[model samples]
Target: MNLTLKIWRQKDANAKGGIVTYQLGGVEPDMSFLEMLDVLNQDLIDKGEEPVVFDHDCREGICGTCSLQINGEPHGPDRLITTCQLHMRMFKDGDTIVIEPFRAKAFPVIKDLIVDRSSFERIQQAGGYVSVNTSGNTQDANAILVPKDKADTAFDAATCIGCGACVAACKNASAMLFTSAKVSQLALLPQGEVEADRRVLAMVEQMDKEGFGNCTNTGACEIECPKGISLENIARMNREYLRASTK
Candidate 1:
């Protein structure tokens, strides 16, 4: 298939960026989106031109490193999939694909399609973990009897990959979906009960400090999330926050 790619290009964080168009041919329908980009890069390299830079770690979609905004949608037009998992078949022949990095104040563009999502790491560090007693008297995690429903919900919330698609999708670029998912993952579990209040407070505070906008219940984040993380997590987090604040 012949395709026209209008991709964003920026030399550095402070450099001015714009869309650069390139015509590509012979794109296989079965080729992953990143693989199509690889073909484009190889062609450019053969012609002594600089290749387009994009973020990608595990192309298997487990890692959310391949965050991108395609034609105004995070992770392209697909539902419940990351950029790396997107296929060339999603576009028709002679289509003009607009590819850009995920846009958010907290996710400043680095270069080309790569953005500094380290803000997410900072938020996670604020209180996304539980302290375990690793001394000689450590309790077995398997010994804890967790209710099946709560366990399922916790597992669902834990699937968030920190891709920032939630932020990008929000009109206000809110990180509430991602932040709430993190909080719910721990707040629902017995092991996480010890510091549940502190965890929610710290994470939420860090999320605000990172310049993320407030969530207005638009539900865009959950619609764009690759993991299908639910808005219910956000409600659960609000309840947790209220409970924590009251205590």
Candidate 2:
């Protein structure tokens, strides 16, 4: 199919960005959005022009690295999928697609469609892991019998890929949903109990320090999240934080 792509181009975080338009043809409907971008880049290279820069890894959607704002929506118009998982078939022939990077104060633009999401990594490093060591005296996971429902919820929360879509989707660019999901993933499991209080406090504090906005309960974060991370995780985190603050 023939199309027009209006993509953002910037030299770096300090560079002024604007939309640059290019026309292309023969985009297969089955091609993922990144593949379509690849075609466009190849065209640019063939013309001795610089290619657009975007972040992507494991295009299968597990890595959550291929993030783009398509037509004002994070990861395009598709639901429950990352930018790399979006297919070209979602568009029509002769369409004009607008693509930009996820915009947030914490996620400053690097170049073109790439943004520095290392803020997420910093937040994770703050308190997103279980500190327990099981190398030498490990007990079988099955020995600590977890309730099925709690286990399911924790697993659901763990699916968060830290894509920062939650922040991009929020009007205020809040990272509460992402931060809460990290907290809930640990809060529900007995293995994470030891660090529960400290984990929530540290993660939340770091999230704020990174310049992420507050959650006003708009719920856009969950709606745009590729993993469908629930608002309940935010609620659970609030409860956890309250309890932690008391201690």
Best by TM-score: 1
C-alpha positional error of residue 88 in candidate 1 after TM-score superposition, expressed in Å: 1.0
**Candidate 2 wrong stretches, greater than 4 Å:** none
Q: Write the per-residue lDDT of candidate 1 for residues 1-247, one digit (tens) a residue.
A: 9999999999999999999999999999999999999999999999999999999999988988898899999999999999999998899999999999988889999899999999999999999999998888999888999999999999999999998999999999999999999999999999999999999999999999999999899999999999999999999888988998998
- Clashing residue pairs in candidate 2, if any? none
lDDT for model 2 comes to 0.93
Clashes of each: 0, 0
lDDT against the true structure, each candidate: 0.94, 0.93
Weakest ten-residue segment in model 1 by summed lDDT: 60-69
What is the model-wide C-alpha lDDT for candidate 1? 0.94
Q: Write the per-residue lDDT of candidate 2 for residues 1-247, one digit (tens) a residue.
A: 9999999999888999899999999999999999999999998999999999999999988988888989998999999999999999999999999988999999999898999999898888999998756689877778888999999999999999988899989999999999999999989999999898999999999999999998999988999999999999999999999999998
TM for every model, in the order presented, reads 0.98, 0.97
